[model samples]
Target: MKINRNFDNLVPSYLFAEIASRTAAYVKAHPDNRLIRMGIGDVTLPLPPIAVEALRRGADELGVKETFKGYPEYEGYDFVREAVAGYYRSFGVTVAADEVFISDGAKSDTGNIGDIFGADNTVLVTDPVYPVYVDANIMAGRKIVYAPCLKENDFLAMPDKSLSPDMIYLCSPNNPTGAAYSAEQLRAWVDYANEHDAVILYDAAYEAFITDGSPRSIFAIEGARTCAIEFCSLSKTAGFTGTRCGYTVIPKELVRDGHSLRDLWYRRQATKFNGVSYPVQCAAAAVFSEEGLRQVHENLAYYQENARVISAALDEMGIYYTGGKNSPYIWLECPNGLGSWEFFDLLLNEAQVVGTPGEGFGAQGEGYLRLTSFNSRENTVEAVQRIKKLLSSSV
Candidate 1:
């Protein structure tokens, strides 16, 4: 039996794994260094109290036969789905409860969503994109096209009718760059998708981190319901990284080739997947509760302040960068003409701080670096001071 050799075409190592490997090697060689990792975008905050309580209550229900649940509904429980739908409504976007499909995480859904489409379809993805979008399509052996997200457009890729791609992957409050699209910018893509019969896979994983006026959901844009499938995670939103719960919205209006995409996704999940655990769904639902929202926002403000510390440093140093305002990531151009990996090594060796090299994202990401605000306030402040010292001494 032959395995899918398409995997052979992937990069030798995942971006984060390589980072971990290098960091590990450094610590082993120089045991004296105290590394403050501002690399991987994992959340450092604990889960909100409301969610924790919900999890405890849900788990306790399993102890009693009357309340015990064997398996969740394939699309998620009505209560949880309603909570998700209610969340959209809060942001001025209307999403039906039935449109939500509970999943382990947005990462899983984003990669697995490609299953419903034929391998022959062409995929359009922004440069310096989240790697999953590119790698998933690569694994499927689909034709992949890159839309250049250059500095001129502020790293927000607009629709180009000339490309005619079948599937478009858009991540706002983008992962590597942390750039988000405006409602008007998103409307252009929505209209373009409807015009070309293409489907947009919109990743709103960082939506909760948005403080600016950018649209939180693609559904806020007119015509998006006809052509967009939105994926969101409680990972960044409610610090559910460890718990692992997310949801995907496939609108009933999105029918392609005489098949409802929602129904297609439902069938796909039911076949290859069991639903998320009841306890986890209960915890996720709490993320939408009044108290849950307050606590999550408090945590978000903590991270946002961390972002301010980092962004303020970049500003004082006269470094060119994007994000860090409405995003937890600060994407900056490397100083002194250093390459991506070069900057990474310099920071690790000199300042003992860790950051993600942008080259891991795409070709356009060369000479750039990504710093996350997911660390503690003290660490964030110290990291900035260290970075400042490094740059000052270099000059």
Candidate 2:
């Protein structure tokens, strides 16, 4: 009957909650100000036309008694899973259909996957990490260690042989920082995890945004299948944020303490989850179709262009930043020595622009800020111009 007291250790507010609170307050005070939000990585584009058509067709099938479906398979529909497998192959990575488990989204999978491991296992996460990685382990009362992602390392935390943690969480095209790890960098981690008998929870939610040569999957590195479980979402990939369909890849080769982790995950889902709806899975499968891919990339390019506008503005302002080339985020240091929240307030008050304060992410994020390219192109262009004008005048 006792509640998990470990929850007491978590911060009082989730990062986005605090940001929303402040934004609401600002809007109330400056009711006439037209605020442009370049925060919260939520996609602004509509779902791809092909996916929309697929969803409609799937729904139509359900209306007919012959094609009606009860609860879906816990792992996902075979067509969706197989489509995901084929999608991986497009990037030169091998993924079997059975290895893929459909879920609500990567956020849910990243937080819930910890359930498979023992509570006694130590967790290693990067500083300035996506908060879910840190908060989830804390809820389980596990000892958590951080690998500092300082500027010296280009914000990519490398493996350290001196430490041996049972579980490691990694995000590429990382949230908050927008830095991605190269295949060589990921290879080092795969080797480290295998040698130490640890497991890596790799989040590849933004992989579709990566146009550079960085790997689209961790399995692109050899030995990763033995030590890594990858989580991916179509939320950012194909604008399925609201529809909520994503997948997890658990290689059959990953076994720890004589237990097959893949089998354990399958059991976990079968027990506690009813699986994504048939129609949503149908739409997700279409994301792998040729026409679906073509439409999805067109939306991605629009966001990429927004990122370019923001980053180019930063360049003109001589602001040091990363991302916006292969990522939809622009992570920049607060200008004029302003602290994270200080810059947040200044930007909102001066330019009517809203961004997430980096301090909310973690200690290493204190003097930074995150701007997203998820808004409309018009809004993004206007936001950058306003930001440039404000900063230029101040300078």
lDDT of 1: 0.94
> Model 2, 245: alpha-carbon shift in Å?
0.7
Q: Tens-digit lDDT track for model 1 on 245-358?
A: 999999999999999999999999999889999999999999999899999999999999999999989999999999998799999999999999999999999999999999
TM-score of model 2 vs. true structure: 0.99
Summarize candidate 2's per-residue lDDT along 118-179 as a digit string, tens digits: 99999999988899999998999999998988878888889987899999999998987989
Error of 2 at 387 (Å): 1.1
How accurate locally is residue 199 in candidate 1, as Cα lDDT from 0 to 100? 99
The window of 10 residues in a row where model 2 has the poorest summed lDDT is: 321-330
Query: Positional deviation of 166 in candidate 1, in angstroms?
Result: 0.3
CA shift of 13, model 2, Å:
0.8
Predictions in order: lDDT:
0.94, 0.93
Residue 122 lDDT in candidate 1: 95
What's the TM-score of every candidate structure? 0.99, 0.99
List where candidate 2 sits over 4 angstroms from the true fold: none
